[model samples]
Target: MNTIKTDVAIIGAGSAGLSAYRAAKAAGAAAILIEGGAHGTTCARVGCMPSKLLIAAAEAAHHAMHTDAFGVHIEGTVRIDGREVMARVKSERDRFVGFVVAGVDAMPGADKLSGYARFIDDNLLQVGEHTRVHAKSVVIATGSSPVMPAMYRALGNRAVVNDDVFSWDDLPKRVAVIGAGVIGLELGQALARLGVRVSVLGARGRVGPLTDPEVRNYAERVFSEAFRFEPRAQVQAAVRDVDEVRLRYVSGADELVEDTFDYVLVAAGRKPNVAGLALHNTSLELDANGLPVYDASTLQAGAHPVFIAGDANGVLPLLHEAADEGRGAGTNAARYPNVEPVERRAPISIAFTDPGIAMVGARHVDLTAESFVTGEVSFEDQGRSRVMLRNRGLMHVYVDRASRRFVGAEWIGPEAEHIAHLLAWALQMKLTIDEMLRMPFYHPVVEEGLRTALREAEVKLR
Candidate 1:
């Protein structure tokens, strides 16, 4: 067996691991990275990039289908070729994945091991069957895989997860998507807009954990135009046939829904990839979700000189958050056994559905009327939104009434991603409502919508 020694042994080469490896290198520490799967990050290969590619195609098809409302008549019928769409998506996806792989291949001062890694003991890591790595500190950044429920597993090849969805040369004419989370809703809508009969079976009362009742009402109303969504779904059983998949469920209204489809896409959620890590070897304890318990700020696992980053931590599963956590993990791992303070940014998240939804800082469920005042704006009648013909959402702003601090904002609206980013920066800076109002608001733009909400927030503060 080959034996190697390093300052840090980083597991997984996804977003978190790569960022941690680079940070370790910059900290003048020798780092070894091990990846058991493909080199491309989830965002590049399956999660975000490919979803956006499918959405882009869907948007184009949607525009053509809705030309009548815009006073533009189609000369002929607008058609979507599923095979060609998949070809384009795969072609672009490979380029992005290749770029990330090339960058990993060229990393300086780091040995890349292509194999599975497990904990032999604290400060000792084993790579596959041959090599053993001795490390002063370890960073566990193994990414997540889609949650395949036992019901779907029983279906074998008939059930498609996110990993298999993107690799298909053509999509099924009917796709029944289980779970109305980000993956289920986005892919469900994209396939719907592209002329696929898509049904979104959501476990929640509404889509994607929207807290505010008003916002939830508007989101369901707007998104309902794209596909069929069942918010309070209780799936009883699933059956697989030679040609199609069948689902037996009781709807929120207590109706028996027996649906059959060409394929079933299950996006219930994802769990941390820690089962193979042999975390039991170390003294690290796992949460109920099987994620290692670690400090959010320091990314340190108790006093074990082991750190957990990215999806493995099972905190926030966004790509950007994973990268930031990776960097923090590397910084702390390099300084392991010498603990120090590290600052973390406010929370932010977005879903890439029609009109979309974004949350910055705290959510409505996290605030109280006595502690924080609220402000709201309706995009049903906004200026730029009217021009774009995409005016279909509402916004809410949360402010600290006593301190007049901008605490958070949640909305389902146009350019939600951009607005959420702005609020995240403002919240991080601890910007007050008055201070935020002093900044420029570009007229006839989506940001003016923010000004309206800010003004409402200011009035409520008094």
Candidate 2:
């Protein structure tokens, strides 16, 4: 086997891995990027970009069908061509993937290895059958894979994942989506709007990433009205029969409902891709889940020269978070014994469902009731939301009682995506509720709803 020496060795060439490679090089360290799969990042390939494309199509279809409320009447029934919809989604998805691939192609050949890497020891890695790599430090940014539960495996080919949805030639007439989390809510709602019969079944009464009971309940009610949503669904069995899959579950009304769908989409969640990396071969301390115990700010695995980042670390799995982690991990790997702690941004996540769901900074579950006061606002009475005929939303902002500082927020509302960003910035700046209220609020806008919530928080803080 050929032996190559480098200052840093990064496993996986996805978003985190790519960022690690760039950061390592910029830190004046020779780094080798190893990959076992295709070049495209998950977001460009099957995640953020393509899913948004599908959601965009769904939004277009939904808007056309619902414009009657705005006094705009169509001459005839609106039609959705499944093949055409998928064609555009696939095409645009490929374009995004191409851009990512082009960047990877520009990297020097010697710095890129097309193979799976395993740790031979802390400072040594075996790259498939051809090469052995000796590096001073290593970064594991292997990303993650969609998890399919054991029951779903029985459905065979009829069971699919989010990655499989973007590759479909046409939309299925009926889809039973499991898990009411981000992936399920986004795709389930989109498919429902696009004229498909979608049933979203989830365990526990959670909706999207919401933990605040009021906000989660509001989201559950809103999405349930939009489609067939059964949170706390008692699933009995799921099996494949012929070309379709059958699901047996107990409904909320205590009735047994057995349904057959063209496909069963398992969006249960994702698992970090760390099992195959032979991490036990290294001297890194692992957690209960077998993930390397690393400092979030430093990304260093214990006191070793190994670092973990991105989806593999199982921290925030969002794209931006992954990039931040990767940069930190790579830089720490390059600097090794002289690694510096990285300043992490405030946590934020958004689900792109219409009447989007967002959580910024601290979550509702993370706060103590005694320490914080909750400020509430309902969009149904908001000026601009009523004007736009999109008056469905609820927001709860949390304020530190003693300090009156803006701590966090959870909401299900129109323009939550845009609204979440503003709240996130405030949390990062450690702005007090009064300070945020002092910021200009534009007249007759969705953001006015945010101001309304802030005002309520101010009142509660006193």
Candidate 3:
């Protein structure tokens, strides 16, 4: 076996791994990046970019068909060519993936290694059969993989994951989506708008990542009206029958209903890609789930020279969080004995379904009702939303009663992705409700709705 020595060894060439590699090198440490899978990051290849492209297409179709509300009349039906749609999605997706791959290609050849890596000890890694890597410190940034339920294994090619959706040559006639989280809602709604018959089924009464009960309930009702949404569906069985998949479930009326679909897409969340790493060989402290116990601030695993980050750490799975964690982990690994905690940005997340779903800072479940005041605004009477015929949403801002500061917010509304950013900045600055209200409020704008909510919170503060 070939032996290589380095200051830091990064396992995985995804977003986190790449960020760690650069951070380590910038800190004057010799770092080697190893990967078994393709070089392109998940966002560019399958997760964010591709999914957005599909959503964009769906939005166009949905808008063209619904222009009647704005008194804009179309001569006839808005037709969607599935072949053309998939072609552009695949083409544009490949372009984004190419950019990421080009960046990887520009890296030093000697610093790059092929094949999966396994832990031989705390400081040693066996990379496939060819290389034995001995590093002073190690950073695990292996990212994540989609979780497929055991029941779906019997469906063969009829069953798919979010990763498998982008490679399609044409959109299926009918799809049964399992999971009502971000991925499921975004893709499920997008597919429905594109004229594909879609049924989004969830076990629990959950809608996206909204922890606010009011927001979640409002979103569930809105989406159900928009498409075939069953947030609390109880699916009995799913099996492959020749070409199509047969799915049986209990409907709202408590009646057994059977449906056949061209495909069953599973968006049942993701698990960290740590199982094959042979972590048992290492002495790092592990959690009950067999994952390494690490600090979110430092990304350090116990008192060892090993660190975990990004999806592999399973703290926050968003792209920005992964990049932040990777940079912290890499820098800490480079300066092992002199590691420092990273001050992270306030938490923020968005789901790109129209009207978008977003959350900033603390979640509703994290805040107690007695400790905070909830200020709300409904878009039904908001100026801009009414003019745009999108006056169907609710916003809730949580303010700490003691501090009177804006702690967090969860909302389902038009331009939610944009609104969430403004709220995130306020939370990061620790702005009080009164201070936020005194900032500014422009007229006939969606932000005016935010001002209304803040003003209400300000009144409660008095």
Q: Give the Cα lDDT of each candidate.
A: 0.88, 0.92, 0.92
RMSD of 1: 1.3
In lDDT terms, how accurate is model 1?
0.88
The TM-score of predicted model 2 comes to: 0.99
Q: Mark the regions of model 1 whose C-alpha exceeds 4 Å error after superposition.
A: 108-110
Q: Give every collision pair in model 1.
A: none
Task: Supply candidate 3's per-residue lDDT for 187.
Answer: 99
State the TM-score for model 1: 0.97
Evaluated at residue 114, the lDDT of candidate 2 is: 87
326-375: candidate 3 lDDT, tens digit per residue = 89889999999889997699899999999999999999999986999888
lDDT of 2: 0.92
Residue 401 of model 1, lDDT score: 84
Error of 1 at 257 (Å): 1.6
Q: What lDDT does candidate 3 reach at residue 116?
A: 93
Clashes of each: 0, 0, 0
